[model samples]
Target: MALSLWRSVFGGSTNAPEDGGVAFWSSPERAGWLTKQGEYIKTWRRRWFVLKHGKLFWFKNSVVTRASIPRGVIPVASCLTVKGAEDTLNRAFAFEISTRAETMYFIADSEKEKEEWINSIGRSIVQQSRCLADAEVVDYGSSEKR
Candidate 1:
């Protein structure tokens, strides 16, 4: 039921691969190539990013399957802000996703791409937060009834 809704919205399968390769049915809300800053080295590396189910996942390449593990994953619900940081980074298409712990930087291919990524992440954060709130409400109501 939930998987069906996820597929309906993202247009991908949730099934694991039969051969233990990539899960071809895994559909993302948004996917593209972007350059991301390395956490320790402070260097930028090109990566393939997929946004789905209120999570942002990056891989070495776009050929994601069930066997392919993400290089990094960011839970959108934990994010505090998503905004362009071109001037601060001195990069043309740079943006930032900031959480309480740290701020991650990324550079898109163009201005439109940068804005689109920011918007997508912002929407995911809002959606995830709302889901959390809805769950809390349900729990509160159930406890009251009990």
Candidate 2:
């Protein structure tokens, strides 16, 4: 039973990355129901949002039973930022994620849910930025920052 639960959350064995890198982190930081703005129209649709690997993925239904093929994905890379959109949208439960290319707005079921998503995504963005900064090489030979 425990093993099955573990496999359902992560995977049994075939959950490795395509390039043979490390496997995806087993658990999601946050997963819940949220409404997403459509691309072409102003229509909003409900989806199961999963935050993993600094990316937000939407599923049609449950994350466990489904094959985890995301209907849509919002990559929260280091450059991305998450903020409340109550002022812009005039909705208490609204938040937006902006990247270099585009900005996506989402509405949570409640104010609490919205706050949780914002904090989780904000932490993810900070974590990604730290990873990027750590991977960068500091030039001691040059006169930059010392």
Candidate 3:
């Protein structure tokens, strides 16, 4: 009964890992607070960012409520890199995510937090690449093991 309620409310499978088994990130990788640029506009706003299922999600604030949906989401698999953007706008704790679609900029509270986000996102990209490589491998005819 409770499980069904959770699935119906969250719209995702209960058996799926809560954080999508992102082993590189922290146990609760939603600790980073960042300022994200609006998707379509030039305005920037503060948001609480979470990484899960090879994607990055942003909320209005740090406290995640069941009723509140994520304000924005970026697919980490499509992201090419996460690196420091100290040159951009002269912000020391700034980092950027370069995706196939667009580059997104964010400001972390400190240098340490900025590095953590970069490391986590970097790991996600590598993991996705490995998964894709494994899936692409095919034994044409000589499957000795099989």
Candidate 4:
């Protein structure tokens, strides 16, 4: 199974970088990715909002299963969870994490637009068996803390 470095950055795995902004990490089956907690096992799920045609097409970051979300138009960013591959594919929770920059997609433009789009879809994307607990939060330094 192939995982991305984003999972590691989110504390999903600590295995260092490999190439193309992508890294290899070992995630679990059921849902979240697996990380070693001092020899013990810790499961963490990543989540993100996907935007297609200026709307919330889906929300997943772990092991989500669904058909390939077609990039109907230029995406304007997203706030969905990110994760490694294999476990997330097909599962509504898993998303093949990537370091390709393009994969760092979040929000449809503004959080407001995203919320509106999501709400328009019935606000069911955030339902259980869909939305997973976020990975440990971190400061990536983007919103002006530079």
Winning candidate number (TM-score): 1
- 7-102 in candidate 4: lDDT tens per residue? 422244323222112111222111112211111223332333333222222223432333322112111222333433324332222222222343
Estimate the lDDT of model 4: 0.29
Residue pairs with backbone overlap in model 2: none
Off by over 4 Å in 3: 1-27, 140-146
Winner by lDDT between candidate 4 and candidate 1: 1
Off by over 4 Å in 1: 1-25, 138-146
List the candidate 2 regions with Cα displacement exceeding 4 Å. Answer: 1-26, 142-146
lDDT of 2 by residue, 1-146 (tens): 22232233335433322222212234778888988887668788898877777666666786443334455555566236798998988877999988665667889989899999999999989987888888996877887673
Question: Which tens-of-lDDT digit does each residue in 13-113 have in candidate 3?
Answer: 55432433333134454456899766667687898887865667666777664444555556566778899998985877889998665778898888888
lDDT of each: 0.77, 0.68, 0.69, 0.29
Q: What is the number of backbone collisions in each predicted candidate, taken in the order shown?
A: 5, 0, 0, 25
Model 1: number of clashes? 5
RMSD of 4: 17.2
Residue 27 of model 2, lDDT score? 72
TM-score of each: 0.78, 0.74, 0.73, 0.17
Off by over 4 Å in 4: 1-104, 117-122, 128-146
Over 63-112, each residue of candidate 1 has an lDDT whose tens digit, in order, gives: 98767756666767778999999998998999999988788899999999
Pairs clashing within candidate 1? 13-25, 22-65, 22-66, 23-65, 23-66
